[model samples]
Target chain A: MQVHELRLPLRAEDIRKLKEGDKVLLSGIIYTARDQAHKKLIELIEKGVDLPFKLRETAIFYCGPSPKAEGKVCGAIGPTTSSRMDGLTLPLLQQGLKVIIGKGERSAECERQIREHGAVYLTAIGGISAVLARTIVSCETYLWEELGAEAVYRMELDRLPCYVGIVGD
Target chain B: MRYLKAEDIQKALTQAICQISYESDPKAVERMRTAHEQSNHELERDVLGAILENNELAAIDNIPLCQDTGCTVIIAEMGRELVIEGATLQEIADRAAAEAQGKCPLRASISYDPLFRRKNSGNNSPAIVHIRQVEGKRLKLKIAQKGGGAENMSFLMMLSPATPLEKIKEQIVQRIVESGSRACPPLVVGIGIGGNFERCALLAKEALFEELGRKHPDEHYAALEQEILSMINKCGKGAQGMGGGLTALAVHVLHEACHIASLPIAVNLQCHAHRHVDIEL
Candidate 1:
């Protein structure tokens, strides 16, 4: 249960160091995606198309933020349930994705994949979007704008709070 | 007889939506604060503390409480003696929902179609409005912005009359345990017993509108609520399901007469970010 400050594009060493229940303050760039974006990402993988961003050593946060209010860099941003993305987890991990952040427990198979791939699953407090948004310094839609809040966002975070829910055995 | 203009209802709803989205109900906040104070585990206390802090930031910054902004659920109790001046209530609600999208930082969570199209409704219109007529000349509206995560975990069961109360308790606890961290505990559990299938579900949802920490009117039901709350907390799901002693903040039960030989139950869970508002006219 150590508290670690981690930067994104996480190294395999960083992933291995995390244990379940450890607190983390994540910083740097993280990609955002939800169920819809996962579906599309999977489709692109199946078609042998290159993704918009590199998956290796990168972290993806499962979230769909509310619309930004006046002068705010981002709107309320919080984690959605991770189980909803279980079906897409293995494929993403196999692509060398290293960190997954969301709320709730993942499937047994997803946990196994995390261990096998040397990845980690972190959880943000569900429903605490406003607090989470304060940590986001900037956000830009990188893809799938038509999906609105479900679009893939390239976010710059500073000390975004989370916990290590699942770590590679 | 009193006459309330339909436009007034629309304006009131718009204001209510913004208020509920930006600031959590004070009673719900106090209950969470109490849960924080009662938690023995360090992680549980930290989690509960974060929830309270998040709510405060939302109020100060004037932002939607959560990213899921939720589907607007409006329950209206209209007095029979009150006459609506202009538009239909449904139309007024829709207009208000659209106005909310324009004025607030709310996400457009509702889909235009549930099936093939699966398109976002854009403005978050077409609120789920439930209207009932009452005796007085005043109109009361209770608005809840129901997040998708917790709403997805709601459950319903039909048990035989011969089934013991213990069985019902077991089912309730089992459902909450299975829901785990997904429904976002420390939660408020709403239990509806006795109504038919659909009615039971509605009763369960309606029960969620009850003020946190308020007991059921019936002494028996109040005792049952306490028992169920204890049972759920014992599951060790804790805050954010990270293993703690405060999984549930409260359990509310609303029961009605049921058909012979049938006992129906519905469980609706609300997340820690209980965003709801009430308006009276």
Candidate 2:
């Protein structure tokens, strides 16, 4: 149970070193998405449209935070179940996505894809959303506001806590 | 005949929603504290401690307990002699939920339609309300915020009258094991036994609102609850499915007599957050 503090946009080598059950304190910028946002991103990829952000050395967090209160960075931002997004995992990994942060176990296919792509899956404690929100320094909706909280957001996180659930190849 | 103001009911419900969202129920907190103290695994202890701290932050900061504020489910036990002025109970519940959504700013998780138009309702309204007639003049309300993660893990099983209770127990344990970290443990397992399909499911969900550590009134059912709780904890999935000694804090079973030939069971999983509140008017 070693603790590793890593900045985002991590290289493949960086992700491959992570093993299941290891603790991580992730800082730097990450993108937030859920089922809807994942669908949209995949649609864009199929249509040959440019993505909103670069996928290289990047991680996508599965979350839909509550509305923020005054003077708060974000509201109760925690991970959603990752299995729901398993269908999209391989496609996103193929596009150079390096890490996925969420709760729950990934499907076998998703895990295989992660290992092949040298990516990792991490789990944030579910239901402790308010405590997790304290680590997020800032957030801005980057795409799909019409989806409400399901919209993709660019979040600047400082020491966001997570546990490695799957290690890369 | 006693009369209750619809506005008063609405006001009470709105306040209840806010309280349930922000303050972890005292019984739930107590169970978490006990689990934290008794857990043999360090990871399980840490997870319980973090959950307890999150509850404190939510209460002090006046924010939601979980990111998924969940769809509002309201159960109202209305007295036969009581008359609600100004609005129907369903109307009052919906308005109250909407009001709470605005004030507490609960995440709007409801989609108006199930299929084609998956649009956010925005107000978290059109709450799922169930009304039952009781004997007295008091109006009793139990509200719970049912999050998608655990709600999605709910299961329904139909068995023959000859099916043994052991088989039923196996099914219940299987559901929890399959849910793993997805539903977020330590969970409160709510089991509904011996009702029609839909009624059975509702019973399971209603069972979740029972106070933690409270047993079923029936001795047989109470023992069954204890048996199931121990079996689930042994599965070794632990807190957050990270592998530990405490997978479930408690198991609650609610049963009603059904047709002689039918046996149906439903399991509703509730996460450690356990967001529910009760009010009487």
TM of chain B, each: 0.97, 0.97
What is candidate 1's CA lDDT for residue A32?
A: 94
Q: Which ten residues in a row are the worst by lDDT in model 1 chain B? A: B31-40
**Mind giving the per-residue lDDT tens digits that candidate 2 earns over B1-281?**
99989999899889988888877668878888887887777777778888999999988766688998888898889999999999988888789888988888888888988899999889988899999999989998999888889988889988898988898888889888989999988888888887798889989988998888796788999999999999998999988998887889889888999999899899999988888988899
TM-scores of all candidate predictions against the true structure: 0.98, 0.98
- Per-candidate RMSD, Å: 1.2, 1.2
Per-residue C-alpha lDDT of model 2 across residues A1-169, encoded as one tens digit per residue: 7788999878766777787888899998899999999999999999998797888756899999888877777877899999999988877888988878999988898888888887888899988877888898998888999998899988998999899888876
Candidate 1 lDDT over residue span A1-169, tens digit each: 5799998878878878887889999998889999899999999999999887888846899998888888989988999999999888988887889888999998998888888888888999988888898899998888999998888999999999999988885
In candidate 2, which residue pairs get closer than 3 Å at backbone N, Cα or C atoms, i.e. clash?
Answer: A9-A57
Candidate 2 residue spans exceeding 4 A from truth = none
Best by lDDT: 1
lDDT of 2 at B139: 90
